[model samples]
Target chain A: DQQVKQNSPSLSVQEGRISILNCDYTNSMFDYFLWYKKYPAEGPTFLISISSIKDKNEDGRFTVFLNKSAKHLSLHIVPSQPGDSAVYFCAASPSTLYNTDKLIFGTGTRLQVFP
Target chain B: DVKVTQSSRYLVKRTGEKVFLECVQDMDHENMFWYRQDPGLGLRLIYFSYDVKMKEKGDIPEGYSVSREKKERFSLILESASTNQTSMYLCASVRPDATGNYGYTFGSGTRLTVV
Candidate 1:
């Protein structure tokens, strides 16, 4: 079974609009959430992250919102540009003394920004 | 900037042959990981190491083995290549953190094709 899930396979948004990508997790112990952006043939690059203590974290045009109660998280990209088109992956990790520090990743959502 | 480098961008190997994929990180991080990416399945961890000569199995470690004799180098070995093993392999490195909120730096990835 998948511990982390990205329900949307693809998303499209107009340039200069807002793009929202959603993710969910079944593991309640996951306390740290992260988003990574990937291009074709390239490895994933870390974008942003949020801890369970905070409900939201923002960096420039990218914002990540975490809802621990719902086991859901969303990434919001404002003023979406064509350069932002890529696959977005959501990952989570548990915080514990014995934790291995391995991250569980979602299936990923492909976002396309149209001009 | 942190940099993780994979030895090969693409590799084609015959079935039943022994294959090796090498990765190196310049950041000197304590944690290194090997993962495979497949369509629909996303990224699945094969193995990871937190210290030299210490390794732990990840979610998918059936046909793969790893070596971390040194801090900066990690190697993934396939005892016998199989067609099903064809996928994009990624390497990542990160610093150990108790909060579990640290982001990982990933290499460009290696595309392996077993025929």
Candidate 2:
């Protein structure tokens, strides 16, 4: 069973515009969500994260919004740059005893920012 | 800065061969993880270790084993390699009991191909 899902396989945005990536989770136990950015031949790097207690968290150009009722979360990047083009993965952890902060990741969405 | 290093960036093996993927983290984090990433499937956890000599099986632990001989090193073992095992393998580390996320740091990944 896939606890987390990223429905969109790819996304494209123009430079200086906004890019939004979406994620959903079927597991209600999950309370922490994170987004990671990956470039070719490199491991994923942390971008931003949000706790379930808060509806939104912002970090400079990146922001994450969570909707617990809908089991949905999104990462928004404003003023997108060409360097931001890469695969973005959304991951979640339940923080429960059994889960132990183990991350369940989505399939990832490839973002292409056009210059 | 945390550095997670994988033994090999690429490896090729024949079917029925034994293979080992090694990972080391400099941060002395308590938790270490192994994952396989494939197209359309995202990242799937293979194994994780919470402490020295302690290990846990993850969602896709079948046909695999792990070793945590020391605090800084974790190894993934494939007793009998198969073509299906061809995929990109990643190792990550985090603090086991920390709530604020000592944040997961991932290795550059090892691409394995079994003929």
Candidate 3:
């Protein structure tokens, strides 16, 4: 079963515009959500994260909003630059167990920011 | 800065061959994970180790085994390779936060082809 899902396989946005990537999760037990950006042939780098306790978290140009009732979350990048073009993955973890740090990840959304 | 390193960037092996993928983390993280990423499938966890000599099977652990003899190294072993195992394999390590939230530091990834 896919607990986390990224419905859109690809997204395109013009530079200087806003780019929004969405993610949905079927597991309510997940309390922490993170977004990672990956470039071709490189490892995924951490972008931003939000805890379930908070509805939103902002980190400079990136903002993540979580709606627990809807089991959905979104990452928004303002003034999207060409450098922002990459595959973005949404991952979640349930903090119920102290020793468990496994993350469930979405299929990923390929974002293309054009000039 | 945390660095996770994978031994190989690419490898080609024949079916039924035993393959070993090595991962090492500079940070003394207690949590280490192995995942396989494929088209439209995202990243599926193969195994994880929380501490030295301790391990747990993740979502897709079949046909794969892992060893964490030392806290800084985690290795994934394919008992017998298959064509279906051809994909990008990722290694990650996490240092847990006070709230049990983890931000993963990932390796560049190893692309394995089973011929």
User: Judged by lDDT, which candidate is best?
Assistant: 1
lDDT of 1 by residue, A18-93 (tens): 9999999999989888999999999999999888889999999999999888999999999899999999999998
Scanning candidate 2 chain B in windows of ten residues, the lowest lDDT window is B95-104
**Predicted candidate 2 versus true structure: per-residue lDDT over A76-106, tens digit per residue:** 9998999999999999987622324679999
lDDT (Cα, 0-100) at A1 in candidate 3: 90
* Candidate 3 pairs with clashing backbones: none
Among the candidates, what TM-score does chain A have in each? Answer: 0.95, 0.95, 0.96
CAPRI quality of model 3: medium
lDDT of 1 by residue, B1-115 (tens): 9999999999999999999999999987989999999988889999999989999999999999999999999999999999999999999998875655557899999999999
Model 1, B49: alpha-carbon shift in Å?
A: 0.7
Segments of candidate 2 deviating more than 4 angstroms: A96-100, B97-99
Interface RMSD for model 2 amounts to 3.1
Candidate 3 per-residue lDDT, tens place, B74-103, comes to 999999999999999999998766755547
Q: Give TM-scores for every candidate, taking all chains together and pairing residue i with residue i.
A: 0.96, 0.96, 0.96
Better of 1 and 3 by DockQ: 3
Residue by residue across A1-115, what tens digits does model 3's lDDT show? 9999999999999999999999999999998899999888888888998888999999999999999999999999998999999999999988723436688999999999999
